[model samples]
Target chain A: MADSIEKVSIVISKGSLEGVYPGLIMGNGARMEGIEANLFFTFFGLDVIRKNRIDKIKVGTVGNPGMHMPTWIGAIPGMSWLATKMMSRQMDKIDIPPVREFIEMIGDSGGKLYACQATVDMYGLSMDDFVPQVEKVLTVGEFYELSAGGEIIFT
Target chain B: MTTVTLAGTPVEVDDEGFLQKPEQWTREMGEEMARSAGIEKLTERHWQVIDFMRKTYLDTGAAPSMRALGKTSGVAIKELYELFPKGPAKLAAKIGGIPKPRGCV
Candidate 1:
């Protein structure tokens, strides 16, 4: 246990459902292990904490090799929606809560949720646009200060 | 695995101190384990969670996930953390003499 992580800072930089879930899962897992966890949402990742679009995140079917389909087929009008629905069903079967519930669970377990100030400003978003679980908007310097002594994971 | 005495009864536990043979667990052992985990005292609410965990494990052959515990244990998530510090699902399972839950959630 000597090498066990005492804290973790995870950076989420994408808006796609697959992109956001890794950071969310990791942050929640760290809290479950009694480790302090912080999730920093930057760039498109802000969608995860945004009240208006949290549920609109869809699986990135186009250009995502993980989808295992041809790029042309992925470009079809409904492919992304179909892919997202299939993924959600699979996740639901495994008892994984939807994104909003997962975020609330992490926050309730003492994991801190943060939004990047620069991204919020660039996207014309304000504190009011985010979910109540978002603890704060942080500059990069403040994020580094908060993440001191912890591993920083960029997803 | 190792055999350790808890509440005057010897029981087998794994490396991280979870019970290796859950069937050998008793209520007195659970209280002793909880006390050692800095709980000091297991209140009625505490037993509610531990009992639910044991029952679930007995029924499902695995410890309940955190999501399941919160939804069905009748304990609010915030209170679950308060009742068992750190991680309620893992800690409560440990105190209840069950293996640590393997779920990712």
Candidate 2:
């Protein structure tokens, strides 16, 4: 019975390049615990499932809370590009991988990754835009059906 | 609340949500996480990233940035990506058994 209750589902809605990691981590963690895990990528979150752009997603440093204070502040007035470059450079200095790699890792794991149908339509993104491994393009209600009776996490 | 000792001090985590005692997160857990993340073996490179992440968390009270991890581990940016497809934060948080990080929220 305890094993039966181990399944979990997660909904990922953040479109920012930086926001994708949480969903990937949680989904992978659930699988590690022997829990059935599914990830629904909606709205901008679909960027992660996008075939080409997924690997190139960058952290948004201008308004991101994690950026260095001075750079973040300076970026307030036409310095956003600089901030993005500077932040990217700093991240490179440390050895953190890019955002796309994380998304790919989540897919490489047994976790199911889905793209939102509505977002796909709105963005005029075709199936070709998404990675070949994506489980499907699903509606919100469909996602809810998959999430029923399981932990529903939004990341 | 259940109290688990870390560095000789008691750390309280919610009884229900807590996965295990901090020290009890053994090599098995690490291996399990690695396998789930599609990593086949636990190599010295993996340990380098994990140890750096832990130390960074301890020092700044925050997860280490990718660049910081690269600098500390001497791993190239591209290679780190290959190692952790979900990036450092995801891999670190999963293996470290820390809760979802704040910024990630």
Candidate 3:
């Protein structure tokens, strides 16, 4: 018998470099443990699952309290770009896949990806807008129902 | 704990003969373990894999998967098998003194 988690539901609500990685990495970890993993994407997190756009994700430095650098320096227009590049380079050195490949790997491991219906409507995106790995677009109520009796994590 | 002699001294190991306390593993211990696995002597190529697995485990709390090691450690799977013939991930991690890799069954 396969030792596996019964269920895990992870919420991805932000699209920034820091925000998107947690869900994807944790989802991959869950799938490795033979868990039934469901990743729910909403708001800007929708862009993470959107086809051809996942690789274009950038660092979200605006109003970030952990920016470490001085506020004025972080306010510099190109800082986010530099930070995103550095983050991507670091991830590459560690052999972490880019967002698109990472998401596909999660699917390959039997994890399910779900998009938020409200966000899909707000952005005027259809099923075609998302990568084929996305299993469904669910509402808040549907998500709660589907995730019932499972662990819910908002990242 | 099981014991494997290294340089005439018995070193404690787990049932599989991997060191029970990885931190106490010495170069002689690694070589002793390697020899038992059919690796006669450590080579630059062999060290490439052993060192990579060791360094990666020390740097990160987790050891790299065999897939990740193949991609980033600059060691081919076939060659890794050639260097550590007993079993690649399990044996190399044993010699390298890291915990048994999570994916190794």
Candidate 1 per-residue lDDT over residues A44-71, each given as its tens digit? 9999999988989999999999989999
Give me the runs in candidate 3 sitting further than 4 Å from their true place. A1-5, B1-63, B66-98, B102-105
Candidate 1 chain A worst ten-residue window by lDDT: A1-10
- Two-chain complex of model 1, DockQ on C-alpha atoms against the true structure: 0.78
Better of 1 and 3 by TM-score: 1
Give stretches of model 2 more than 4 Å off.
Answer: A1-5, A66-97, B1-105
TM-score of 3: 0.64
lDDT of 2 by residue, A1-155 (tens): 13455557787788655577667767755643446779888887888788777765655656566765655474566455565466557754544345555555445545688888899899998778888668888888898898888888888
Q: Is the docking of candidate 1 incorrect, acceptable, medium or high quality?
A: medium
Residues B1-105 of candidate 1 have per-residue lDDT tens digits of 889998898899988789988899999999888887889899999999999998999889988888888899999887898898678998899999899999998
DockQ of each: 0.78, 0.11, 0.07
iRMSD of all candidate structures: 1.1, 8.6, 8.7
Q: Give the per-residue lDDT digits (tens) of candidate 3, residues B51-92.
A: 888888888877787557656789864465556544466777
TM-score of each: 0.98, 0.52, 0.64
